[model samples]
Target: MSLLEKQPNTSSEFEVDSQRRHEQDAHLDSKLRTLRLLDGARAGATLLALLMGLAVLGTTGHALQAYNTSRFDASAGGAAWLSMWPDNGAFDVKPTVALVVGASLVVLSNVIALTSHHRFVRARLAAAHTPLTFSAPFVGLVVAIVAVILFYVANQSATADTLLSWSCRWRFLNTASPAPQFASLCRASHAGVDLAILLIPVEFAAFVLAGFELKLQRYTAAYTHARKTPSPVLA
Candidate 1:
């Protein structure tokens, strides 16, 4: 072919290549935008879950304290620690059920947050970006799981047994004053109380971590999009 004729063909091929590249870049940009939106949504959902879990934990703590107080009053007259009292109105049943239900709900919330976070990571990877390694939602999930287990154990066991000894006040009542036994039980119960208290901060930390992750994800996605797109010049 003559040089002049070959020139047109070469220019046409170059145009086709440039057009294809532009189209590919546009496609990538669209996908990245979709991912950014998804990540934002996942992050929001995670935050909501964390908050709900915290509320549940707080309720569980309050319920447990109420139960312990009622138990102490019932055992005051040298009554058997295990002796059922009507003063509390089915105390064991109500607190136990509330705590178990609360734990279950907390666990469910963590599971939901975890699943959303996993999806967020996958979306980031698909967009050719490094997924977040550590996040608040993940930390919150871990703390929530631990809290659930601790609360379950605390609620199921009768705190009174640890605090007071079962005895017939008329027989061998002086053998061992319930005082020492009650003290020891109180100490043990306090340990669980301390654990429940610790969860508050842990849960808060998890929520903070999730918030940071959400912000970072949003920032990174915005920066990436900005870098990929060409700036339009004013004529």
Candidate 2:
């Protein structure tokens, strides 16, 4: 064959090979991007779970402290107790606020993580020739259950002492000790603490299960993307 004639054929073959290489590179890049997104989603899920666990622990601790404080006041000279009534109300207020704020943070973190996981799953399904489903709704259901338990604990009723005692009257310059009212309040506090102890474990389990669901979604996306791409490294 003439050199000029053969040169055209060689150039055509080289162009085809270059195009194939470019397509393969693009596919590999896409796979890498999907995997990175999955990793990020999984990390976010883990962080959310940890935050929820900590919040549960904090709330439980607060409940226990309140219970102990109430019992102490009931046993002491009623009004003489540091935890009694108006004297140290601020101390109780601070812990309650902390519990609320921590719970709020946990809910926000989980929601963000769930949204990120859904995005990652959708992206993978679009790029790959596979059927994948993400179950964020189940996680939301579990969160709702936890919220209900928290609400129940927060709204329980309390009664305080209102009896008349000479010491309480002298201390507060009043005619009553309010010991009966204080005792009732302490009983309510103890009830709340018991309820909290029962609910915290359930909440912790829900958090862990949600984390597992997120991790499963992440791994599924990573695996499906690797399978579709013609790359041995990812495979």
Q: Highest TM-score: which candidate?
A: 1
Provide the overall lDDT of each model, using Cα atoms, as 2-decimal numbers.
Answer: 0.50, 0.46
RMSD of 2: 12.5
Cα lDDT tens digits, model 1, 1-235, are 5999999999999999799778767966776666566556555555555555555545444444544664575476655643533333323334334333544555565555555456675675644332332343455556555554654554556543211122111223332433223333333334434544554555555466555555666766676677689889899
Q: Model 1, residue 179: displacement in angstroms?
A: 22
Candidate 2 clashing pairs, residues 3+ apart or interchain: 159-185, 160-181, 160-182, 161-178, 161-180, 161-181, 161-182, 162-178, 162-181, 163-178
Q: Write the per-residue lDDT of candidate 2 for residues 50-123, one digit (tens) a residue.
A: 45435454544454455455556666744554433443422233333333444454455455444444666657
